[model samples]
Target: MGRETNCTEAADTLQRLREVPIEALVPVIDRSDPGRLGAWQPVIDGDFVREYGSLSVKNGDYPKLSLIIGTTSDEGASFSKLGLNTTEQIFDYPVKQILTAKIL
Candidate 1:
């Protein structure tokens, strides 16, 4: 599955018909490093298609077809680029909302 704030879960459930017999991944999100994104990731993405992704087979009696889905394009890059340093900076502003600080 995923950690948090990842669209993979939604995409997996919403658009799993695209790929069959293949489960989707979580785009390898950042697990450590404290930050808004870090904190947010696990809160939501921990259950996207259950990481291994979901396997759906068409047909009741006979398994004629199977559908699979994984993290979409760009989502991986977006998730990868987002590090504690980058996201933490967002909290540095006057709000000090937590996202203002980054590891960088």
Candidate 2:
């Protein structure tokens, strides 16, 4: 959301947000498992890593925050040319990554 502005004060603002502490977050918990943990949002490191740091790369000093950066084939361009995009197109990569990240 941080696009460099004509005055660049906008750019500075986003950079500062990147340094903002993770909101009342519990990155280690997830409602996805045990079914008994309730609906607590999981604190995935990916959120901390990508939050606004990547979007604010124009003039900001990338913080020393640990982030898990990645991309999936879920992007639109592949299907954009064909005018069709769906989760089916991304089935393979998501499944593969889930399996691989488990071991590594």
True lDDT of residue 62, candidate 1: 31
Error of 1 at 38 (Å): 5.7
lDDT of 1 by residue, 35-92 (tens): 4444434333545433322222222333355665577533433344343244445344
Count the clashes in each prediction.
26, 3
The regions of model 1 sitting more than 4 angstroms off are 1-35, 38-65, 79-104
lDDT of each: 0.39, 0.45
Q: What is the C-alpha RMSD of each candidate to the true structure, in Å?
A: 15.0, 17.3
After best superposition, candidate 2 residue 42: deviation in angstroms? 21
Top candidate on lDDT is: 2
lDDT of 2: 0.45
Winning model by TM-score: 2
Candidates in order, TM-scores: namely 0.16, 0.20
Residue 1, model 1: Cα distance from true site in angstroms: 24
